[model samples]
Target: MSIGQSVSKHRFACVTAVCAIAAACGSFALGVGRSIWFDEGYTLIVESQPFARMMDLLKVDVHPPLYYLLLRMWISVFGSDVMALRAMS
Candidate 1:
């Protein structure tokens, strides 16, 4: 590809990134104020549990703990409040 084509691609990528950020900010701002969806509620509950208990719960649902472990760390720092949980995602 030529220099001009490469530069154009970079510009498009940057613009897309900016627009995506803007859209996420707008959507999540309102989302935090709203009630959690079923899965989001379940996530909060699962991640808040003690690790051993959390593992048992995950087994019933047949999910890996990787994501929940990360989320548990995130919640420990930011909290499990709707706003905090929504922000991490």
Candidate 2:
């Protein structure tokens, strides 16, 4: 409503955005290039397959297929590089 209030709100938003971006960057930097764990390794294997095959495998596997399906699409757009894959999270 008031000029001071608006400026304060804008400054708060900017600070929040900057903090969020910095946190994400720091998290990604720490995780990037790290060795894939068992679950992520499974994701890599499942996501690399054909859609139908991935689905079929999921039928017998314990985990759901939704994440793998999305990962498949992500890999299609971004390639299978480790950093790119981890960043997709």
Q: Which candidate has the highest lDDT of all?
A: 1
RMSD of each: 2.6, 1.7
| Count of residue pairs whose backbone atoms collide, per candidate | 0, 0
- Candidate 1 per-residue C-alpha lDDT over 1-89 given as tens digits, one digit per residue, 9 for 90 to 100: 99999999999999999999999989777886588888889998888788899998999786777889889889889888888887777
Summing lDDT over every window of 10 consecutive residues in candidate 1, give the lowest-scoring window: 27-36
Q: TM-score of each candidate? A: 0.72, 0.82
State the displacement of the C-alpha of residue 60, model 1, in Å, after optimal TM-score superposition: 0.9
Determine the backbone clash count of candidate 1: 0
Model 2 earns a TM-score of: 0.82
lDDT digits (tens) for residues 22-77 of candidate 2: 98999888886688778777788888788788888899988777778788888889
Q: After superposing candidate 2, which stretches have Cα over 4 Å from the reference?
A: none
